[model samples]
Target: MRLPRSRRRSETRDVASDKSEATSQTSLPGDQQAAGAARRFLRTALAQWSDSGLPEAARLGERLLDDSTLLVSELVTNAVVHAGTTVELVCRLDTRESPPGLVVEVSDHHPTRALRDDSGVLDESDVPDDSREGGRGLQLVAALSDAWGISYRRDRKTVWCRFDLPAGDGATPLLSLRGEPPAELIAPVPPQADRANDQEWAGRGALSFLAEASDLLAGQLDEDNVASLAAQLLVPRIADWCAVWVYPAGAGARLPSVWHVEERRIDGLRSVLEKSPPAADKRPGARHIAWPATPGDTVGGGALAVPLLVTGRCQGTLLLGRAGPLGLPDEVTGLVEDFARRVALAMGAARQYARQAMISTVLQRGLLPPAVGRIPGIDHAVVYEPLAGDWVGGDFYDLFPAGDGRWCFALGDVCGNGPEAASLAGVARPVLRLLAREGYGVCDVLDRLNKALADEAAAALTGGTAAWEGGQARFLSLLYGEITPYAPERGAHCTLASAGHPLPLVLGSDGRVREAASPQILLGISETAQYTSESFDLSSGDSLLCVTDGVTERRRGQRQFDDDDGLATVFGDCTGLGAAGIAERIRHAVHAYDSAPPADDLAVLVLQAR
Candidate 1:
């Protein structure tokens, strides 16, 4: 939506110096002399505003009057030559809180006849050329004033112009829909070419101040600093007061807080505080939210409040104020919002940097546990790689002893990724290790894990209750195992229990490879789930290779499969390789399986029975 028009005069010919002191005079007695006097008064007022210390007021004055003074001259000229009647001009400074500005009116005692403004020939087409000279009086008046029209009383009709000048430094005039000047009054003595030069010079002086304002905002994202610069710029452009405020901190949907304040006096803020704060929903963020001044408040000013938000979070607000109640234009409001966004991004970056550092510290401490304690006839090695980028892969390995002179270990993939998924792994990993040591069998270990995951999953679902749908809810995919070993020279045996985990690959002395497909049920689904154990015979020089899906599922181009047979064939065909050799072969095969690095996190564990 568009900003509303200002209601006071900015460029009046005889605007009073002390707005506090009211003036009642309008026109001088005679026609020719009065037109000349009006022109002179306008030139003087324009000069004073340009030279005055109150740049904000001067800016408002310049905006209100520049084109308007010319229109007044054209109107007066028309009354003298065409109306054949003396016109009475009355200028009043309407400083009311609602329609605060200057009003200029011209009245004549000719009620029987309407004022006909026909200073131009209507062509086949209605467009007017710049070269046209005779008919342009009423056109000029409508072009300048925020609103201009004629009203008739019983005996006379008054032609009046109302200019909205709230802060004394109002923005550029928004042209009317017709795109034509309203009215014109011709002077008996015309302005020479050199006189036009003087007006140009005056216009340049006014523009220079606005240029200063642009320069001040060019290199900074600080809203407070920009407001101060805007106030200073307004002063040199016109004689007026300036004020600014910031969006308050901790404002909610019910009410918003003010951030920064820049004003000529404390009374300006007091005036605003007396009125209700703007509705938060109407002007969500970084868009101007304006409020009218209180009825009896000591201040009369215009305000523009813009919120600063980035990534859906509010940073702050920028509020600018003037001495009267006028709102900012959309263009100006957009510029302020852009500045606010830049500031918000800088702040967000700083916060993200600190958070990343903290995450890194905790992850480092959670790296794989040191090599498991020695078992006389066995040698082992383990490797883990965390998935890169934002995703946190939940691959974990554990090794602990079962009381029956057997050692147990498990490698599993907990479904999902990132901090929350990592958090679930963080809880499940250590708990499983403790449970194994506490004599819980494979099924019992999974039963306890499911209980823990149930609570964790519920919290996740509840936290996103607004966004949750049945299809989008989270679940985990996990695998667990326990192994018991015996003396290999005596053709000893090992018993294996699995919880939906990948089968261990066995390489025999006869140059043959096979997988021990143990019966299994995935962990963390239900408490009553059961898993059976599988037993296998072993001898010296035999190797057991257990790994996560990240290894066998490695992809080259689009093809991906669990290459269990290929890996077993390689180990059995090579022959005579120990635990370390088997581990090295698996790692090499993975690197070669993909022309590029594997997409998921990879884990590998190898054991040899001597």
Candidate 2:
């Protein structure tokens, strides 16, 4: 990971252009903390380079920034652990040419420990042991950079790498780095002896095909798209026909996609694959199989079957067929197997991601409240918008009949996200409902919820049960209330309590808005948490709006959707709207405020008195 001082400086000088070159250097002690310092230094360098009026840094985009940061950490850590000497780091950006590029060099005073292949280039195999904990730094450099190598002097050694900036015109650029010529300038002519060069040339072409296929696969996460891409990539390149058969959970294999060079053969190939038996081994990996050629078949080659195995389970199979009389060579077959392995890994990851998403969706739905039944003298509407991510958020709302002449409703937000937050919400909602049904007031219900959550947290901390062992200590901000009709006065009596939750807004009949209650401490923090109810009257045409922080805290770049005053103004403008109309208006306004998806979950409940 470390490079020699003299060679590092020489390589930097070779790539550095006086017209538009910027360089930064730092030295770190060879210790565990060097990697962190190196990453920080890289961040500062990138920031300064970006601000120095260099278009190259901007063109490099966020991906390069991430990759370069990772590379620096890996290289610096390798030097700290292996070289055991102070490490010198240098970063340079050159943009005088039509296309720009970057060079990073790490030098350490350890000459005898240089890692290189027989040809003097750094290679993966040069790492002495595969089973060791931390020897993949060079491999990552090779994979991430356009070019990487090592140079040794009598007293020091240097490891250096370079990357070409993506073209400003958006075209893919060649990977040539410093001291390397463009591919067109060094293009090789085909040998006159076609047969002698055929095998070598085909090998190179196959490798290129695999590389392109890997890039395509990496960009997609859908199972059907991946399977179809695999099929299409094989057809007209390595085979005349290709078919992908995927095995669904607890079901037999099914052909998801099939491709052929000739349109007429597509149906026949699909039928053949559909009727084909599982591989003889019935296990994971790749194999060659005899084609079940029909009597009228025009094609002549055999078929190769490669299983898509994930974690030792066969998830699917990839079948490739050739039209030539001769079978593929041993090397070609091995390459096909390698291609199958990559597809398998991608498919497995996609499947796992899909499963987790489904689970999160189901949990979210289960924790959410059901639709409110008809309530006398009241019109109500609620909107819930979850953030756009894999995990379920902790916002929730519910409305149900508390008892005779009263209805209970609650809106709350747990502190975190994902399953843990969802679990806490799940526990809070039903317990609050049960206590309210048993005739507890708003304040009493919240007190009980706090105790339940505190007990759960204590159980989790003590590992008292399997259900609580992996649980997280969670807190919630809640607004709970009950409403009863005043038949004699044509209004409703409302009792509301706030526990560190956003204050509920009341939109008056005359176009004024105000908060319903003052704030209290959040739940699950203290056993002696005291909550008090605030009583208010909802006259004809008056509406009470309750929401979580997701509404008030929604961000679009530097600006939020609305603060408390802004929300009050918005509410006041909806003076004559019904409950559902006003709820829809606010939801639409929040959506329009930020076209980008909200980073947190949002919930709003509105109740208008008749």
Candidate 3:
């Protein structure tokens, strides 16, 4: 959405020490951004007036500038919203008095259009009803100016407001907004000739504009926002109105984002453009195009359109419109074309990111088991959540049968995030499953998987050494185990190893907790790294917990979830809980540790002897 409208005033006549009128005038393109353009023009005039050093000119206070700018924004907005025509803005300071007074006036094409109520009508009188959304801008104008009123001629309507300048020391206004102006001033004076607007986009200003556009556009991961920002940056700067039409590949759906200097005319403009889209012109640069005038249109009907070319293909069009019989100047067309190129690049990047994320999501589903296999002698529950933005995160877990009377379980975290880390975890799991099914014990399964990951890392590094140290290492930390029911009355036999993972915890029926396995160096750090298994018996009413560091390393400010054996304490309290209940309890506690969502991937697996 566009930013909320600022309260501002009209422009008029000013006086200096020599009794010469000091004035600044410009013609606004009557689109939605006319208010913003008007505010900038008023600011320049005030700055010049302050620097002119006429009598009492040194006393231009912050309040005076703020009130004047807000007044101009309001009046210009009213004109653009309702009149839908070019706006004439004039600012003048009467510098002869003790504290100079500034006069401002904004004129529009619709001289006879009266205000309506909330249903979007303008009020005919000075006091608008409490609920006129259309007239609120004008109401704000009335409140900020010392004296303000409308001057209607046969051809133009002008809103003039006067502000008694404040002292630099910040004195209050001499008079409040007293509804209508003097009767003599209310009568229509001589009409004015529209001043030509001078636009120069070649220096620091253009650089700043493009720089700001880059910053805003680059952060947008959605193409719609990119189109919206492009339109906003164009209007009332180089073009009076703009439309970015994006065509989704293979879908034939045309999404057009339209913006105009006049907010009220946006719907009309959009409807017209959608009915008549530009040709799918793949040629580079920009050229004039035929744009049909909508109903009640008065200004800015001429148009120019450029292709939104990304890479070598044309995906859409960027069309901009302006006033006058002749179209935009060559420099403006060139500038807009350059701006459109940047917009195209941003859109391309967004689409690429979305495509990758989608692929990652699809691959994530394929990489993990559809459902954990049920073991005959154990009740188990598992909770797995990847980081929000990472479709394929670093954390993963699996529980599946290893043939015979054996069951294998593994939970692991790769060194970093994104695709590289995810690829490593993908390779590690399959190797572990293959080794376990081949009748390898827990330590042997770990050893074989470690070598496979190391080989993959070496192959990747041999291809390119420059990025090997750039978070591309395939090092892994894993907690792997195998279980067998040796006796029905007693508990199951558990063989497990912790390869730099969070030490697994065993909870006794009496609420006592202790580490199940000792820590070993992370796998894939070196192929020579060896592992050892810890064998134990879990009697009835005993539960074992296996977790990736994502659970143990969860942070709230400076403290981690496992800073002081936090996970062990929580596990010890789940003495009587079933496997599912214990998993949910720990998941809830981790999430509740901080108001924000967990920043890292998390996986929890619990096994209770049946």
Which is the winner by lDDT between candidate 1 and candidate 3? 3
In model 2, which runs have C-alpha deviations exceeding 4 angstroms? 1-12, 18-208, 279-285, 294-299, 461-472, 557-559
Candidate 3 lDDT score relative to the true structure: 0.73
lDDT of 2 by residue, 71-146 (tens): 7766776777778899999888756544466777788887665445666544445553435543345766666676
| Sliding window of 10 residues with minimal summed lDDT for model 3 | 181-190
Who is ahead in TM-score, 1 or 2? Answer: 2
TM-score of each: 0.42, 0.71, 0.63
TM-score of 2: 0.71
Order of quality (TM-score)? 2, 3, 1
Off by over 4 Å in 1: 1-347, 350-354, 402-404, 447-479, 484-493, 561-564
Model 3 regions more than 4 Å off: 1-195, 198-212, 232-241, 250-253, 260-276, 295-300, 322-327, 373-377, 454-471, 485-491, 525-530, 555-559, 592-599
Give the lDDT of residue 563 in candidate 2.
Answer: 56
**lDDT scores in order:** 0.53, 0.73, 0.73
Provide the RMSD of all predictions against the true structure, rounded to 1 decimal: 23.1, 9.8, 17.3
